[model samples]
Target: MQKVTLRFSHNNPSCLPDYRNHSRSLKKVLQELNIPTWQRKRIPFLYYDDELVAAIGFFVCQAYVLQESEPSLHITWAS
Candidate 1:
């Protein structure tokens, strides 16, 4: 399974204790299975910044996925 270290923000070095464990499990399962791209799921997390945050999961059903994506600035500024 693919593993990744996710930090909600630069200020928060660690995730909440409760969610830290579960989040790890979810990520593992998601990585191992052949999930579809259109199937959207949200991984709930507890941010160290004292707030709850969630990472939206989108499985591309492909190998070697990149953890993050760069927004299309041109599209955003076009309007």
Candidate 2:
């Protein structure tokens, strides 16, 4: 069995690597979406083992994206 986890933390978005292989700040993306400052830290971050898989409601990491016909995890975010 694999270990997957979901965490909610006030992390520095600039430190998270994007699917584009760039270190773009998640804060900037959230700001563009008009998300309030107080709510940014409440977003859930998905992880597979220790690697970041996706930031719920945002982007999924390149390496973790599902390929055609590949097995995948179905995640649903509520609230």
Instruction: Please name the candidate that would achieve the greatest TM-score relative to the true structure.
Output: 2
TM-score of every candidate relative to the true structure: 0.19, 0.67
Candidate with maximal lDDT = 2
Q: Which stretches of candidate 1 lie over 4 Å from their true place?
A: 1-24, 42-79
| Model 2 residue 58 lDDT score | 78
Q: How accurate is candidate 1 locally (lDDT)?
A: 0.32
Alpha-carbon deviation at 64 in model 2, angstroms = 1.1
lDDT per residue for candidate 2 within 1-79, as digits (tens), equals 6898888863544534343556566676567568898887788887777666677887776666679999866867777
On a 0 to 100 scale, what is the lDDT of residue 47 in model 1? 31
Clashes of each: 0, 0
Question: Lowest-scoring 10 consecutive residues by lDDT in candidate 2?
Answer: 10-19
